[model samples]
Target: MKQYDKKMIVKKSNELIDAGFELSLNESRLILYCVAQILPKQPIKPDEMYFVDAKNFSELFHLDIAGVYKTLKNAMHKLGDRWATVIDKNGDPKEIRWIISRQYFENQGVLGIQFHPEMLPYVSALKKHFTQYDIKFISRMKSSYGIPIYELLTKRRDLKEQTFTIDVLKRKLKLEGRYSAWRDFKRYVIEPAMNDLNNEFGEFDATYKTVKEGRAIVAVTFHYKPRNKSIPLFDKQGNPSSEAPQKRWEEYGYRSAFEFREALELSETHEFDLTDAKEFLKARGKPANK
Candidate 1:
């Protein structure tokens, strides 16, 4: 089957953001990406439901047959039951669920889902004050918390910081009962997600500090910087990286063959002969002896 470039927008309601909710990050990302693929370029209509082949979803996400099946089953069972609670300007609380209806065709290898009718306006025809981001940002994220934290941080990227009360933080992470102790939450949840973010984005990509009131931890302050877009020179280890080295002689400015040899010595694995080194030096206007 011809594969189209899979792209999607993660559009969340302002009310939903304030209310906070939980989701299996893995399933949520996959579902949003799949739905976005079938959506028209214009605003999505409430009546519209998307039907996608299991094979297509697998290809887009680079999942194997088993993974595809597992993802479908997870989506059908797990995500179908997920819901969010939000409050309106009138201070009325609303319970918002994800899917209005869903079906899976096993023999035909198809899954269909219609997002809740109320959600269409939020996910589609988004104008302003919405937390919107490309689907690609979360694709490589390992931890479930990475995407949620990223979304929250990116929304406040201009401020370069976010402060949440301990309770509010738990709600945002949907970890109400999971990690009761602050230490456990920091170690297992926050640290791992930040590490993964930095690993993929850059060192110190997202960091946080505790806020305390008279020794009682009240809240946490999260600070983030834009991902370092520059390419890395060395690998994770401080070694001569395998990535292709500078090609131009001017780039390195080796004065003699000895300098070139010295550079290669750092690698300790690159082999160089005198004759080959001589030719290289001559081409760069450096004498082998000098």
Candidate 2:
């Protein structure tokens, strides 16, 4: 097998990775492309305009090239309003903009972004404990939650384990007011993100242990370190084996707990039970998925 070469490396401070922010997959890719250009010890000039082309964006994220120009334009236009909440050197929370300036070169099919001066401490001149990873790891991931989860795991690849409170996890991922139930949270968010990482990412293997306060899950501890170095991301046949969450879920005789619940008219707010699904399929003389 030919070795996979990660041409662009992305690095960010640990604080930034754990910071609260919500961005579409395209928006995340655009930011990463710009960050990958930074040299470890070099200075990033505020006046310097880094450019991102639709063609490159499409190729990087496996997006449709024809639609990428519009995608790039929209993400760039909205990125200026997005902010990251970081704890400053004095341990006070400060909200920082992701972009100080955005340039649209419509005819050139490219967009330019200038980082905010406030973002300098997190993105540049990082001395230690910076989260670094191959951008390709998320290129084929289909879920929005996949991107942040990958970053969360990458940030702790050096440690034996790092625990995150359920509240903190929800805040960092911007999942507030949603997935209030643990089952729904795990089924829809956590599991899919972990599936994506375990299959697509090559640098490390990630797994988690849940901590419960009585019967309620209150926190999670994530563990990571490289187990295998080679995981084929793209090949002639198709996307990586774990790219589609539904396909993986099919092996258990259901697309997912959601579908299994839907078939029996169970509440999404309630726990997901697949037992009825198996009996339901058997009653119809249908074999469950192998």
Candidate 3:
């Protein structure tokens, strides 16, 4: 678990990013921490246990040790109860748990998670068309909506634009009823989240403009532009997110970048990003190309 930067990376397919799920800041922190722990290029499995150690959570997120035990103990149950609604390959809306099981040892402050088999394609072995960001960027962000908004825009960085219908955005953020007024949504949700993204990100500027109809705000478009700073191919955590890899392959061994199909369960064809081959090569104990 001890890697560079002491940072946690949350990499997920764009589908999961746009899926309808609402998690509080604590819940987001707990799940994201576990997702980042997935060893690089090692595909996730439904039965594989992913754990969130309260001590690890405390150190990474700058939370008090005592408080993390209590906070995460509570968030553990709530997160287990959460399920995401996503559109399936047949264009059907399906409700699926990103996590299929949650277990915690009494008084240990360690919570274990099992990724729903349905989510392996989205959260693991990502090489392309996925959103990769260090959770530390929003670790301390107080806005409940900031993390989701950050992801919605982060995934579209290649296109530099993401537009969402007002209704659709709300459902994705799980903000349908709250922030009932345009100003409230803008001031509380949009603006604050934009600030969080801008502050944590480097070599990028985040901006937004509202689309209105006869004084009614109907949609919102987020824009990203590169800044002058030069970034590296990988982060302090050794996460190679700066480089644009090819689109992800739908099935393992169904494509060339990954040869260990037997290592993962076969998934549906409607998938996409295969991250760099270095980690996969490294896992096989082969000398990766420079």
TM-score of each: 0.68, 0.72, 0.73
Query: Tens digit of lDDT per residue, candidate 1, span 145-225?
Result: 776677677654446678988788787767787777778988878887787667662323778899988977778888877
Candidate 3, residues 1-290, lDDT tens digits: the string is 33225645677787889899989888888778877877445655569988887887777766767677778878877877788888888988888876778787757768787888887887886655566665666675666787888777666544568788889988898777888799998898888777766774433578899999998899998887644312122332345444432233333223441232211111111112224233343444433322
Assess candidate 1 and give its lDDT.
Answer: 0.59
Instruction: State each model's C-alpha RMSD to the native.
Output: 15.5, 17.4, 8.6
List lDDT for all candidates, in order: 0.59, 0.69, 0.67
Which candidate tops TM-score? Answer: 3
Best by lDDT: 2
The lowest-lDDT stretch of 10 consecutive residues in candidate 1 is 229-238
Model 3 residue 236 CA deviation in Å: 16
- Model 1: residue 229 alpha-carbon error in angstroms: 8.4
Measured on C-alpha atoms, candidate 3 has an lDDT of: 0.67
Which candidate, 1 or 2, has the higher TM-score? 2
- For model 1, the superposed segments whose C-alpha errors exceed 4 Å read 1-5, 38-43, 52-56, 59-62, 201-204, 228-290
Per-residue lDDT tens digits for candidate 2, residues 8-39, read: 66778889998988887778888989887675
